[model samples]
Target: MKLVVRVKLLPTPLQAAALEATLHACNGAATWAAQVAFERDARRPLGLRKHAYAEIRERWGLGAQAAQHAIKKACDAYTTLKANLRGGRYGRPGTKRHTRALSKPVVFRPEAAQPYDDRMLSWQHQTRTVSIWTTAGRLKGVVFTGQAEQLAVLAEYRQGESDLVRQGGEWFLIATCELPENTLNAHPVGFVGVDLGIVNIAVTSDGECHSGRRINRQRENDRALRSKLQKKGTKSAKRRAKKRASKEARRNKDINHKISKRIVAEAERTGRGIALEELTGIRERARLSKPQRTTLHSWPFAQLGSFIAYKAKKAGVPVVHVNPAYTSQECSQCHHTARSNRPSQARFACKVCGFVEHADHNSSHNISRRGWMAWVCGARSTAPALMLVA
Candidate 1:
């Protein structure tokens, strides 16, 4: 498994200036290369590399590897744009349409940030520092610190390419490390259902709920603040709003990490696999009022699901996503599938069998059953039984 561990860099003023200069040069080269590649219709990595290599190295005063990396970054952006066009996500017609230009003043490619080998960018275990390459020269003994667990992983796992990111006035080294996959344990005895919703972030078949109330309230406060700041229409106000948005995002992400960890740990401890609803394209399909749309769009169901899956993989616990057709409206006890079964957001009362339960809990129970069915018969066969309810 590959995981990225972000280490905070403690660089002196001079070192920081050099690092920033290097990033600026690299991003400038990347932007130029992207424009050249687009105009010349050279989108492939090698083609773009060939077109930009010599010119970028000479003009930007970047190393050979850095120049190549910059070209690769440009090519990657073009590839993404092409993909979006192919997927009909561009929402416009022509393949040769004008592409958006890079606006960031400082961005570093992996090679620009590090090097081909550890000689230029390597960790010193004894000093707890790292050596990083820059445009001016190599910066040795730059202190970098991460969480103890992440530092331990860095000590053991093989480090791969990394990017040097500057966020909110702080520099961070985001390194990708390759870790050995955990051996799968015995097959799970049962499945734990995890229902994801807007009101509650997640609810398990075991009746545990991770409420999204706090997150929603925080977002509301941030939204109001953002509105007031925008009304001021001042540069400082805009900057403050941006910073607050970043902080809010970090807070929400931390909460998600904690919730996902707990959910995966629950399944691991119980020796059970996790069952989740398949929510792909949910946003596009769901019909909602303005308020409902805003709530649904802000909810991070996909991110939470991804976190759970990755964590479960590390813990040797399986995760399966089942059909989400009527997990909420269907009665878990009576096998009744009707909108009337779920009369309210929180209540689920089956008219046919007089079954009553919390709506989300009932959905979770159904999700768990669907997951078990999938585990037994495979995902393909689980859909036919999706409407069966019980």
Candidate 2:
């Protein structure tokens, strides 16, 4: 239930310059840390390394306090690397996470909102411009509201539990409030299935398909234009490239927003709990080429899920995630196993039971069923799942 609300910073030219300097410092610290770590690891593959703070102060000429901060960041990266290794995720070598690279200098929590202060503020138009104390500050366009309302609610419901995060950059937060405990149905509402596909961005188990506006044609045209510009390699070409990047980014975000909002609306109207596959791992599957992988990630399924959960909670609805095992292949009616179930992208035909349905609908149905099974087996609570089914 942790959420991060982000807002843009409207800074003066001088302030913007200061922010840029802060980013440079953060990047410098990261580069220095990376170099040190790389050298140490190269010398001894499993060598015990010096403390980040001590090394930063000694080798990078940073103050004790500044050294401590850099060391803490390095330690966080170390923890992430170790966790990834333990989880069998050996990919590209560690580098500065984008958020870490573009972070701003620390400012006093209370003074953080002061316009003159280096730190940025997160404001809401309540009775007036209300500001909250947050640890996060502006790096680029995004600023994470560290003192998030959702975090407060989570702490109240689940004491002492915390979600570690590094956020800030073109992200916004939405939250669900006034959530009720399990009280949806006599038998309890169960699951929601979500199918992510290319033709349609999402297909819900609830008989609703969220269609994506076909932009592939437009993207191809844009790519062709970029290729032409690359051949020219002129100043105008560079300007066109920047313009294209900005335009495409905006268009993609608009698409994501529409898709996510529709899913939330469906969940509220249908009263079904939500189910999402652990998509983080699936993005790395070898079946997809680099471009295909990029397209899959570009769909913003995770962001859509987050939107649904928070919006559902506000309407006294809930969401639950279940394992996405053969949701695409398993026939919803007879549990038949075969690739033939999905002979085409849009259609599903059951080989075992002669049941047929739209490919997305079948996946949604199976997702709902799996969530109910999990609930009955006491794997998780019933309230969240009931919202979707009821």
Candidate 3:
């Protein structure tokens, strides 16, 4: 399993200036290369390199590797644009949006992240410093910091390329580490089904619930503050709003990481696999009021799912995605499906068997059973037998 570890880089004023200059030069070169490719209709990296490599080195005064990287970045931008165009991301062909996207060559920000290979960057884990090649010169003894665990991983498994990123006036080196996966547990004792919801955030078949009340409350406060800032329409206010948005995202990501770590640890300890609800197209399938829709769309259910998946992969725990249709309203006891079975968002009372249970708990149990059927029994029924959680 490959994991990305981000470490903060603290550089002296001179080093910072060099780094800044390097970013601007690299991005400017890349933009120029992109224009060349656009004019000549040269999308292939090697062919485009032949056209722009010499110019990049001379015009930008970049090193050989940096020049190659700038050209490669330009080629990659075109490749991404091609994919987005094929996927109709901007719009269908002939539409104004689609035409506008293709009208000009893609341009990169001056502070855009640049990749550094081993020849261009070196890490000293013991000293917590880095030595990197800059356009001005080679910078040495640039201090850096990261979590203890990430630092250890970087020392051991860090390989290939690391990106030098400037975010919010701070420099960071995002390095990729290839961590070995644990031995696979092909036959699990059982499955831990986790039901994702707005109120609870997550409810496992084991009846463990992670409440989302705090998160939602804070989110509402952030939204209110951002709205006020937007109405103010000042440059400082807009900057504050952007910073607040990034802070909120970081907080939410931390919460998801904590939740996923706990879930994966529990499943591994109990020799169980995880079962998740396949929520693809959930936003389109469900109907809600405007306010409810806002809350629903704003929740990071997909991020939580992905967190669980990667953590489970690292732990060698199998994860299965079961159909989520009617999971909320279906009774775990009688397998009866009806809208009326769910008296409210939090309560489930089966009309057929008169079984009363927490809505999310029952739903999780159904998901757990379905996962077991899919994994152990090879039964991929749309509706599997449900029962009380063990």
Question: In terms of TM-score, which candidate is strongest?
Answer: 3
Model 1, C-alpha of 59: deviation from truth (Å): 2.4
Q: Using lDDT, give the best candidate's number.
A: 3
**Model 1 accuracy (lDDT, Cα):** 0.77
lDDT per residue for candidate 2 within 40-118, as digits (tens), equals 5422212313535466556545444445444444445656656765554654345344333323222222111111111
TM-score of each candidate structure, all chains considered together = 0.87, 0.57, 0.95
**All candidates in order of lDDT, best leading:** 3, 1, 2
Candidate 3 lDDT over 11-75, as tens digits, reads 99989999999999999999999999999998778999889998899989999999999989999
Superposing all C-alpha atoms, what RMSD in Å does each candidate have to the true structure?
A: 5.7, 9.4, 4.9
* Cand. 2 TM to true fold: 0.57
RMSD from true fold, candidate 2: 9.4
Clash-forming residue pairs, model 3: none
Error of 1 at 208 (Å): 0.6
